[model samples]
Target chain A: MNLPPLVQTFVLHFGEMGSRWGINRTVGQIYALLYLSKEPLNAEDIVERIGVSRSNVSMGLKELQAWNLVRLQHKPGDRRDYFATPDDIWQIVRTLVEERKKREIDPTMTLLREVLMQEPASAEERHAQERMREMHDLFELLTGWYADVQRLDTERLVQLLTLGAKVQKILEMKDRLFLVPGSKKSRRDDAKDK
Target chain B: MNLPPLVQTFVLHFGEMGSRWGINRTVGQIYALLYLSKEPLNAEDIVERIGVSRSNVSMGLKELQAWNLVRLQHKPGDRRDYFATPDDIWQIVRTLVEERKKREIDPTMTLLREVLMQEPASAEERHAQERMREMHDLFELLTGWYADVQRLDTERLVQLLTLGAKVQKILEMKDRLFLVPGSKKSRRDDAKDK
Candidate 1:
């Protein structure tokens, strides 16, 4: 169960980065190993590769499953449980975004809304409420946009992303062509559209 | 230096949420206090209100400054430093995104790129490299989009956000009117744009 040097480096780095991403080192390492694994990996495989306690591996796998970042499978002839990451990376990204929004963003939004419901008893409370309202609006808008984009097919999303800064142009064009009526544009501008 | 119940609730919730967001509780509490404060708060005020040690408050303030979530200010004839969050919530959002990208995303991208450069010594390494490439490409596209959006003026950004799912309509309209040639649409459709 020895990992190759490259795998080891990648896993170790991910393990370090995991804390900053809000997961523990072992969870990150386990996810990295499963993600890079050519075949489904069993708990024994993870235990040997990561050198963590059996219970620790069990807990890490559970956390990953909860995050929807890992899936449990069984080998045709094997009795033990196996784990693997989804083959599609885009799905993985979507799952990460969804889970994080659920865990981190949603609660804050809820709290802000609750706080906003309270009557301001003082000037300080009023100012704080104003700030909270601003935050609530921003989060709501951003999350709403994310939800819209999340509905897009992966290919269309990729196309949109590949357009990158060109999207600003599309936004501009939408403003110019549709917002203004009968404004004459050069043929070059027409060609630049979309 | 007792915090009102409302502020206490917000601060405590943020402290609880902080670890999940990859910051320590003290730092989260400190930032929450500063963010809601009507005037700049010195370290002593923070320590008293949050009920943490002076050293902990000092460390948390330092961490918040590093994250660009807090700024230092000075009162006339006062040598002690005071801290406050930016008045504009949008600016705070921009700063948060920028700092998180620097601390978390950028290094991971750099590591993934480095790993991609190495020659895969085996099939296993090759599979790992492939996964790494997918991840690297995803991060690159996302960061690139963020960079483009970051250049937008706050008003433009807010307008774009407020558009939310309507943006998809603009995208579709662009395809219809611009991508397809000589397609006639009603003026009502034109008004619906942007």
Candidate 2:
């Protein structure tokens, strides 16, 4: 519970930004604490440091586990369950994005699809469908591209991101190469996907 | 206020997903209504349709305006203000990303930078600082790449995303091209050997 001042400052800042991050104060604080800790921590440690009720820590851990943001571990000869953020920082980022898409985007995409399935009975409804269609298409492309980028290994992902806008020039080059007659079909297909 | 079943379903669904999106329920519902509306809607129209108190709609509108997600308009011969989402859906997406980064990411980045500047007083704090450094570096990469991608016009963004993992192959090709005696890509990258 006696966190160094540096760690404590981060925990407090995270708690303040909790609502903005779509988590409660205790949840954000707990995650931040675990994120900065060198080792796993039990509920007692969280409650003591965060100064929240035991039940608040329990609930925060439950929500965090549900989001796959925290992992549970058992110490040798110790019965208390300990929690830690995933060790791979990039994995944490990937999990955050995937979990968020599952919660916020997938549901809206479903709703948009369901609504689009309905027949519009009025001009207003028809106009509404146009907007929904635009949303649906945008989400489809975005999610598809996200999945593609998400599947890469952390090194590859970092490379892709570091490449930045240079990727656009590469795509143009690929197109020009494809213009050549009798280009390798299998290579073309491979580059086109996966 | 008399929304067709299709539109109403989306409104309700979006409201349900509001907390997940880091917005209040009424704010989500209001945005959904405005997003699908053919014309700008006044507060009365929002209250009547959303079935919330006038004050609730007013607060929701105020929050939306603060987030820059909604635009305020004045009607000829009407004293009441009207609200509508940006007409360009891509622009709306950009605004949401920019606003969220400003509110949620920028502050955290500042905190991380400040905390990182402090000297660690103990071994535990040194380990914690390592974790913080990793996070700081990851965020620096992500935010930098995001800014690069964000600066591109929508057409270019779509092209870059649509290119998908093919971007990796292009990088490899560029590397090989630079491997020639007088290559252009700078031979120093050969050490990466990725």
Candidate 3:
């Protein structure tokens, strides 16, 4: 089956962007095709639409499944496996964030922790450990926040996103109303009260 | 100068992860070295420490500077250039986010917008366009939120991040106390009120 010109353009663009995001071009193209497809498509359909080998489509599908970006389905009468992206865009975004955190952030955090545990043998080693500590702390803060936000319902998450810069106003209000002047302990106590 | 084993372990690990983050191994290693170094390093020092060619170190430094990941400094009496990562980790994080957005996210967003402008030629094309629209909307929401948060002072940002799951409670409070019941429009209006 031939893809429409518009689909073709998007597929090509995504294919090019895939390398920059660590996936191969074929996997990106296959995901794009699956995402835009109105119905679940088999490997053969993907190969025909994407102009790749059957094996390549199979491999790409496998990788997408591993990333939790695509879902496998079976037709009522057909025995061949079919695939499609989640219908909800927010779910797709959530999957992408979670998978990336697992693959990219989690391992680095582990390495930083392990490196930080070792005794610094020199001033240079001490500085490197300090840098690693900073990185580890940043990653912990980010990933922990993401994990918390990930639990929110789509409606609530959208509310937060749409607020955008208004959140800064909210943060200022939080600081002014919650914290006692000149005491970190009061801030901690206020956070607990909330 | 030879790097300590502890620093070497981190440099090597970062080098491996670098390819996944869209940079080559040498560039990742060079950045890691500069980030962990106690003082500014010159090209010769980097080349010797990273065990890469002088030309490769020069090119990697060029790339790092382009990403705003490394700073170029000159010794008062010496002609040779020196490089170092920013002392503040938040600054580095901000640069990484902005640069990646510029390179990876912005172009895809522009392409999605342009593609959305074109009239769909068929039912399949229409479905593809819908998917693109969803993706574009998600990207807009995310990048806009990021830009807003980027403007925040580091202390405030840290407070927000450390709040983690507690943010959900805050959001719920905002919704109940601030927004009029049963209307998305009212919630948006309330945001504008502040």
Candidate 4:
């Protein structure tokens, strides 16, 4: 499948992005193809369209399926599986964010907790542990906040993204307004607190 | 040169994270050391400290220097270069954001622009171009907005992150308050049309 120049650029960029994001080049390229293609594409079509090996396409598809980034479709009278991205960009964004948080944030938080539990053998150890504590607390608040933010409607999410600098102003004032800004804030904060 | 168990965990996690964030594992491990260490360490020290090869430490330090993530410190009596990370997490965050935007976001925007200028040869080509344009615009705005946000003081950044759901709610309302609902509006939208 010969790609149009525009999509070809997207494919190449996403491939590079995949490495940056810890995914492989082939996975990124396959995702780019799926994201751009208007129709549900079968494995052979992806292999043909993207000019990758059939096995590579198969593996990439499996990874995409694992990430919940693709929806499977089967044609009438056809046993081959086809895949396409959801129409909603927000859904795609949410999945990417959630999946990443699960892989990166949650595990790091767990490791942090274990490190914090270790007894300090020296002043340096104590200082290091203190820093770990700060990071762990921050990440916990951050992950919880993001999960809650993810629960917002797409429009609401976009609103937050577009807030530009206003969001900064609000965050700085939050502590002043509520003194103790723990997870147990108020019902309003809890409403969106996921 | 042995590391505390907790620090060892940090190193391994950062090594994994480095790959995810487009940095090499060794480089990430070196960075984790720099971040957690109480003093500036030389390249040889880092090699011994992390139990990695000298060449690997050299390469990792080179990459870290390129990212502007690590600062090289000079010791009066020592001939070797020493490195350390800023104590401020916010500074590191800003540096990473800026570097990633430069590497990934900026180049992709340029590619999108070039593709947009090409005349469409078919309806499919036209559709692909349209999608590219949307992606390009969204990314440009996002990076621009992020740059603006990055300029905010730490107090402001924390304020924004803490805004959480409220920020999301505000972003969702961009359509009603702004002209041209559900359409691509440039920064020029703020200015009246002739």
**Clash count list over all predictions:** 0, 0, 0, 10
Runs of candidate 2 with Cα error greater than 4 angstroms are A175-194, B180-194
Where is model 2 chain A poorest over a 10-residue stretch in terms of lDDT? A185-194
What CAPRI grade goes to candidate 3?
medium
What TM-score does chain B get in every candidate?
0.90, 0.90, 0.91, 0.84
- The clash number for model 2 is 0
User: What DockQ do the predictions score, one after another?
Assistant: 0.40, 0.55, 0.68, 0.35
Q: After superposition, how far is residue B61 of candidate 4 from its true place, in Å?
A: 0.7
Indicate the residue-level lDDT of A43 in model 4.
Answer: 92
Model 4 agreement with the true structure over B87-161: per-residue lDDT tens digits: 887788788878988887787788888889999887877877777776776786677678778777775557566
lDDT of 2 by residue, A1-194 (tens): 56789999888888989988789888999999999998899999888888889998999999999999999999999999999998899999999999989988998898888889989999999999999999999999899889888887787788888877767677666667655555655544434554
Instruction: Tell me the spans in candidate 1 whose CA falls farther than 4 Å from its real position.
Output: A180-194, B180-194
TM-score of chain A of 4: 0.83
Higher TM-score: candidate 1 or 2? 1
TM-scores of all candidate predictions against the true structure: 0.91, 0.90, 0.93, 0.84
Instruction: For model 3, name the residue pairs that clash.
Output: none
lDDT of 2 by residue, B50-151 (tens): 899999999999999999999999999999999999989999988999998898888888988988899999998898888989998998898888888888
TM-score: model 4 vs. ground truth: 0.84
The weakest ten consecutive residues by lDDT in model 4 chain A span A185-194
Chain A TM-score vs. truth, each candidate: 0.91, 0.90, 0.92, 0.83
What fraction of the true interface contacts does model 1 reproduce?
A: 0.60
Docking class of 2: medium
